[model samples]
Target: MSRPNPAVFIAFLVAVIVVLGSVTLAKGGFYLAKHEGDTLHLLQILFRMASGEWPHLDFMTPIGLLAFAPVVLFLNLGLGVGISILLSQVLLAFILLPAVFWAGMSRLPRRAAYLFGLSVLVLVMALVHGETERSVSISMHYNRWAWAVSYVVIVLAVLPPREIRNDVLDGLIIGVGLAFLALCKVTYFAAFLVPVVVGLLANGNTKALRGALASGLAVALIVSVFATLDFWVAYLNDLREVSASTVRPAPGFGLRTIVMAPAYLGASAVALGAIILLRQAGEMTLGLALLLLAPGFIYVTWQNFGNDPQWLMLLAVLLLVPEVRPELRNSFGWPLAQALGVAAAIAIAFAAPSMLNLAYSPFRHLSLDPADYQPILVRNPEHHDLQVREIRANRVDGVVALDVPGSGLEDRVGKAKRDEERVSFQGTPLPYCELQMGIVAWFEAIVTDLEQNGFAEGRRVFVADLFMGHWMFSSLDRLEHGAPWYYGGLPGIDSADYLLVPLCPTSLSVRKDILETIEESGIAVTEVRKAPLYWLYSFDRDG
Candidate 1:
């Protein structure tokens, strides 16, 4: 029997995934606080987008508008995060897996179809499985979407299309792909130009290339004009904020991760050598592609070594396995290499559980502590770093604060049981469980104290990290004051009654800046609450 159509087969796979997701979500009660804030943020962005409020003018996402629209559209219509994720998976499955399936099934021997399918699963794991550094749920992280777009772009950039389409379909795909990437941090978007241009020539399909370029430009032009009319100042501010996000404390990521640069450079060089020695167009194109993707990938990794180097790793494995080629499929070497690839993919999938825990342990929204405010003590001489000592001293005075924005009351029925059930934390330790338990317990005690002390209803908090604040207190209004993007000042700072803050050491500078901003606004605030990891300040509206 002939092999199944690659697109048709992957479509079926995606359907299974969606069905599985639905079944898992139907069981309900899975909550990861790591996921909570993110869900709210996406909802916020989608709402804003629906209202014609694009980035810079108000809310923002690092990825381009194209990537967010479909998933956000599904979500804004009152669908749960499960459906959002399912839809995202479907979209990505269609956009990315099809290409991967095509690469294996079209080029390799017919018998190697299983290898292609297994390879795709391994790549998906790399794309969406691992727990992020900040206890973010795998489902919530933007990295998942980023990787989805990046994988397809990386693969397409290096490998020429096997067939150039005469219709607008390929152009639409390419255009939409590039447009989705357009809103990404500028440097990352720019890095793909070489490969895209090279692919244009290598494919020798002027129609597809011209169509792609035109469609991309048209999309960009429209977005730009809209931004210019809507909020050009906000758009300019957004560009500046993107630059500033990279301006954090130096040596942010580990040195071990940093070493990946030279390693990537070496790998690219070897691929280049292979291209020169082999003297084949396909080989040369791949080698060049590897060479081009290496620096960009390495740079981003160095900036933030999150998840899915395994995407590259999986691709590398596929590329390195020689016996999968049609002519060599029957050779003994073919079976051995193919087995090894399958084994490696299995090993990665197997390791994902521990990786999920070791990296970000399970957090459920179980009991909250209704504790009294606890005073903290710190001695400057005892600290090794001046920064730490200063931060501790400031913490004691309640000069800076971090608090989850909202009423400290959401762990009930969970947005109520059914709505909560709509999100499944698959990569989480609970495996589709909802309700954020304490991996490191969230400071719900702090929220409880503020609520008891009269800082509860109709109040807004300037969250140090929306992911944390929104999760703990989804009921409250939020102002994302923790990042530079919100530097322009909270819109209604004077009217707000409380300045909530994260009391953690990492928030010292954020707290300091936000406090300064509030002070400059001339609003009077009295430190009303302090607990481990949080600070609450009540405003004196009369003053």
Candidate 2:
């Protein structure tokens, strides 16, 4: 079959973007089903950037600048938050479109190229973060965006060009994709860099290697000049701080679980099976390169919140060779081509749920009833676009064990020692309770409670909890140098006026850790105000 026209593929991708973008915009806002805390964190970052603050400079975050820069660019142009976010994805797809086209056209067969382009575009434009969850959310949108970029880079590097080879062009794409991953989220860059380099070298793409290095260095130099040399140091510092955080080291599941857990074992086996089949088919270099790439794939999945295996779709495509020779057989006497085909099909099956969910999310958004949702940022009208379901926003839910003094279970157990480890602040033990939902209500009530008591304006509150988004809901000023979501250490503590300890904190362990760290630091805090919702303590650093 003749190769599909490159223009036709590019046009098809653009059309999909336009259709998805239009449908997303038709909603006039973004509605989230879950992950309100994460959405708030993203809001804080965008707000800080809009107010002339930079990540790792005026604020603390492990997320790289590029993650928010695209949205910030649209925001700077005076667009609403929802519109900015939507447009940013559209912009990202377009930005990465050239590389997508090149990789698809050069490396993949005609139909596969179309599918490849569509996959990248879907990842870029999808409203919800990847998962089988039908709910729509903008949380961790950057991760999806980063994965899209990774697809392009891996496709270009691992797969040899079937149609035409342009070493310089291929290298530039790989370099820019790597740099974008670095600037957007370093986890991807760190995970894929070695394997990508190895793949290029294994293929003897020497000119592409040189081109990649120069382009990567050039991009880094330009960023350094613009963002200043201190930016890199600050970025590294933020990453290091996050790395040490006991409150939240990894979002979900351990690295081992990601690779070996029952839920993930099938995908992992399929990946390994692909490697074995590739080698059996006399593609030793490709197989070896894939072997090196597997750990990185696992690492990225382990690092992400939902632990969705975003690499499977790409792996499925990678396994699809232009020609599958029937003569090749493995030691088991099975035809290598058919075995590879089965493996790729299994990979697709593993990936289909999330991929289908991602592709269908915008349509899901369109069907949502406006009456069912309310704005997350209650005070800011410009942010009226960011909304959550009223039930999720208004209804607070938590797990509270029946530990009544005369309860039969307690009597039977003779009082568990775990109860002895209750989190305490200022020598008073806090209730062992944690909030599982109603983040919007939590923030709104606290802000209102503070306002009612005249501790509202110009106060920098260091919330002793997992998330610090109270400032986003009210007139309260952000904790200078504070984290949107606490990673580790007492960030912005010295600059804080009050340490607000919630009655029902989001993460009890986080609250305990923060309070303990503060106590160890010897920062004197005196109880200033007590309410049903929280206890406010005035920081006395001088003492």
Q: How do the residues 329-428 of candidate 2 rate in per-residue lDDT, one tens digit apiece?
A: 7789998888887888899899999999999999999999989999887778887887889999999987555665677676644455554336777778
Whole-structure CA lDDT of model 2: 0.87
Off by over 4 Å in 1: 1-53, 60-63, 66-68, 91-136, 161-168, 184-188, 221-236, 246-256, 260-282, 305-308, 317-444, 463-475, 480-495, 502-506, 516-543
> Measured by TM-score, how close is model 2 to the native structure?
0.96
The TM-score, computed over Cα atoms with residue i paired to residue i, of candidate 1 is: 0.61
Give the candidate number with the greatest TM-score: 2
lDDT, candidate 2, residue 14? 84
Question: Can you write out model 1's per-residue Cα lDDT over 45-130, one digit (the tens) per residue?
Answer: 54456555565565533434554566567656755543454455445554555555554443333334444444444333221335
